[model samples]
Target chain A: MIQFDQVTKRYSGGVEALKNLSFSIDSGEMVFLAGHSGAGKSTLLKLISGLERATSGSVMVSGHNLSKLRGSQLPFVRQHIGVVFQDHKILFDRNVFDNVMLPLDIIGFDRREAARRVRAALDKVGLLGKEKVMPIRLSGGEQQRLCIARAVVHRPAILIADEPSANLDRAYALDIMELFKSFHQVGVTVLISAHDETLMEDYGRRILRLKEGQFTA
Target chain B: MKHYLFLHWQSARTALAKILRQPVGSLLSLAMLSIAMALPLSLYLTVMSIQDWVGKLTQTPQITLFMEQSAETADIAAVSSALKTHPRVKGYTFISKKQALTDLEKRNGLNGLTEGLDGNPLPDAFVVTPASLEPKQLELLQKELSGLPMVEEAQFDASWAKRLYGMVDLGKHLTVFLALALSVALVLITHNTIRMQILARRDEIEVSKLIGATDSFIRRPFLYHALWQGLLAGLVAWGLTAWLIAVANPAIAEFAQLYNERVELRGLSPLELALVLGCAVLLATLGARLAADHHLRRVSAN
Candidate 1:
């Protein structure tokens, strides 16, 4: 579950990225954050993931207050939330399997368990045979799928994708959305930030729109 | 703890693999670090060997006893017999006034003139050599020898030996100071290298952090990179020092022989080698930690 109450993010340069944004997503719910380039969509995901602090509001993700969390406790909170970026953030030097295993390794999973989970996650993303292939060798669609596989390999309670379909073609973007929908069907809370109106229109899930720095439901 | 260690090892392995991808760069960095570490260490080994040589040379026991000119033959005999009977005294020679005059004349080219003298002008003396001449024991022996009833004065002529010892002491202190300064420089060098690496890989770190990787998890690989760099550097330094010593040993031996002194150049002792390695590892780890913490904090803030 993720909740934000009047969240505002103001940079020291007098720029406000998000202003008075209030939203909540219940457990296992699939939601889309739609906005323009600077409409606070990425900032909202960052706040939920505890990657950025809110300037003047409360942010609660899985019962932990984002603003008050100590440095040492940040990792524990992070372990419960999975994040995927639009850039297909896969380590190109490593094979697809190892790249997917990154999240499990970060969470300190046992070796045998990590192997099992990596295989299962890769399988779910339809990348089973490509485990040993380097990420650079994969197509753009597959690379995005690998990033998705990596984010969910640890079975985190919540999954946040920041512009997950921004760089992909329509076909690949639709495939990724379906993948997110499947993850949500399995009772994993999913939040996606995107400017693709057509993609959001097809899904017909709860949509929160943003303009400038304000959020409107 | 076991889990943490396992994760750390995995991260380290990944880092090693990544470095292996750029073998030339890794090797060059290692070579640079090794050369930096070995310079002062070789100097320290040479100084230690010199100290050991001086120590061995100063082990011989020798003392001088001076007596008054008014002392009689019986007093001289009593002093000689007492010295001969002393447990620490290995040998004693009575230098009578005539023998002393003869020795002085031979040295100063006054032999013929001294032989024409009417009477002996030199006083009675004794040359006593002890079985052991450790510094503290030699001082004690000097005190006891001066306490003899017939002995008017006892001198140990330890000035030359003391000066040698002082030089060795000063050398050790200087080595420590120099080693510390160089170690600090080594830390700076490592820090700069890692900082460059962090700058190059900024995007990777940001993505990792954004995806729920903890600071320590992200830092582990860099830490391992630093550790391996340090270890390889230490080995390199050791090899360089050995090579330099080998090249210089023959010339050093020849020079010592010219001065009528047989000195052996010593290699690093086990403790010294261990210390060098430990210091190298410490500096590298410290540098990596500093760079990672600084860059990671900034990136997280951004």
Candidate 2:
């Protein structure tokens, strides 16, 4: 479960990115964040992922408050929450399989176990047969799927992504959403932010709309 | 513990693989480090060998005590007794006037000259070798021996002994300063190398951080990379030092032969070579840790 109470994120130059926002989502729930550009969608997801500290108030993920967490403790929190970056954050220097194996390697998984998990993750994202292919040869939608595979390889408890469907065609974007839906079905808490209202509404999931860093009615 | 060791080995292999993939760059780095290391190491070895040669050359300083013509055997025995009881005197040899005359007659150039002499003009002498070569102590011992019964004069050749000691002291101090300065240079070089590596792999590192990797997790391979670099540099420096000594040994031997002496420059021993490798690895790893931690902290802060 994740909870945010009176959260306000003010950057160094004094631009308020999040303003007194408060919300809670139960475990195993799929939630959508819908807002236009500069609507604090990325900032909100970053807070949930432990990538940024809230200037004021509290962010609670899995019963631990993020603001009060120590620097060393932050990684442990991140290990449980997998994040698919907005720009796809895929390493092009290696094959698709090695890219996904990075997370398991971080956790120090043994070779046999890591290989199994990597193949499983690749299978989930339909990249199992393309294991040896470098990321440059991957199409944009396939690359997006590769990012998803890498994010979920460690079997994180919470999976979050920001603007995952932005650059994709309607068909490919819908396919990517279905993949997140599959992870959410297995009792993984899923949170996604997208500006496409019609696309997000099709899932019939709860949507939190933000306007100028604050939620709208 | 088993898993930990396996992960460490894995990191080491990955680090080595990266270096092997870039042979030219890795060799360039190794060349820079080994040459820097060899400079002080070679100087240190040369200084030690020179001191060793100097010690052998002037191992004993003998003060000669020439006796008066009228001194009898009793006077010589008294001088011998005093030298035996003296704490500063290592040992002494006696030469009666008759024995001195016979030795002079047997000499290569002075054989005929001694035949023209009358009544063995050479004086009886005692050659006293002191245990301590300290100039003040030698002068004091010479003065005391000269004041003894029937002793005409006492003196020792101290200039050569004094100059050798001074040179040895200077060489030792010079090597110390050189070693300290070179160690710092090696560390900074390792730091810059690791910094470039971190910057080149920024994408991989950032992604590692984004998905649950600890700062240490990301730094392990880089530290291992530095460890390999340090180890190779140390080993190469040892080889280079040995090769240099081999090249210089003939010249050193020829010089020694000119003085009817034989001195061989000793290269680093196995234990000393091990020490160099260990130090190189330690400093390189330390540099890597600083470089990696600094970059990681900055990335996490933003």
**Highest-TM-score candidate:** 2
Off by over 4 Å in 1: A132-137, A167-169, A215-217, B15-23, B65-91, B95-125, B130-157, B242-262
Evaluated on chain B only, what are the TM-scores of all the candidate structures, in order? 0.77, 0.82
Best by DockQ: 2
Flag clash pairs in model 1: none
Off by over 4 Å in 2: B1-4, B56-60, B66-90, B95-124, B130-139, B149-153, B157-159, B300-302
lDDT of 1 by residue, B171-193 (tens): 88888888888888788878887
lDDT of 2 by residue, B13-123 (tens): 989999899999999999998888998899989888888877876667788899999998888888889999999999989888888877866753466665676767889
